[model samples]
Target: MPIAHIHVLAGHPRPVLKQLLREASAAFAQALDAPPERLQVWITEVDPELYAIAGEPADEVLARTPRAQAEIPLIRMALMEGRSTETLHRVMAALSATTARVLGGDPQRVRVQIDHVHPDRWAIGGVPASQARAAELARRAAGQGG
Candidate 1:
């Protein structure tokens, strides 16, 4: 499963945010080989006073540069480590494009943080994901798991 945490200054319409979530899920499904249903997306709307850019609050930044109001979304993605650098790079590119399309976000202003966690550091149920993943891989190789 891939978990995405997105933060943006509060203002965009709910429809836009919904579209963004939809697009982001699709992007993850395609780029990470994760099932769409298994993807986890969390959007956090931050007040302009709480979100700062370049040492200035978002509101101040926007007041100083009106044209940049729609450009400051930040996306953070966490996934199990093991994927190749090339794959991660592609995921970031796809996500950035999807975000830009949904919100008309500026490519330069959009920020993405991808965190790859070791399987041993994560868990599902009571078992470490490293063990579960190993078993799953074994089963898949034996044609017993999907």
Candidate 2:
């Protein structure tokens, strides 16, 4: 399973935010070679007055600079910890590209952080994933030929 949490400065239109959710979900699914239904993505908008850049309030930054140039969305993702480094890199690049495109910001400014968790540490319905989804994990491992 893959879960992505996107944090952006408040001000973007609702439609843009919705597009980000849809596009990002597709990107993650495609890059992970996983079904769309297995992925989860959500966005949290932060008030500009509450966020800062270089010790300056983001509201002040936005007042002087264009929103596209001033805004930098931070994306954090959590996934099971068995993917190869190459696969992780691909996922990061895909997410960065998607965030930049949907948010109208430079791809280089997008921030992506991934946290890999062992199955024993992840849970579903109060049961550790290691035990609750062992068969599914086995099938995925087999499909990946790992």
The number of the candidate with the highest TM-score is 2
| Angstrom error at residue 39, model 1 | 1.0
* C-alpha lDDT values of all predictions: 0.78, 0.91
Model 2 lDDT tens row, 1-146: 68999999999999999999999999999898888997999999999999998889999999999988888899999999888788899999999999999888999999999999999999899899999989888987776531
Model 1 ranges with Cα > 4 A deviation? 67-70, 137-146
Model 1 RMSD, rounded to 1 decimal: 2.8
| Candidate 1 lDDT tens digits, 92-121 | 888878887787766677788999887788
RMSD of each: 2.8, 1.5
Worst 10 residues of 2 by lDDT: 137-146
Question: Which TM-score value belongs to model 2?
Answer: 0.95
- Top-scoring candidate (lDDT): 2
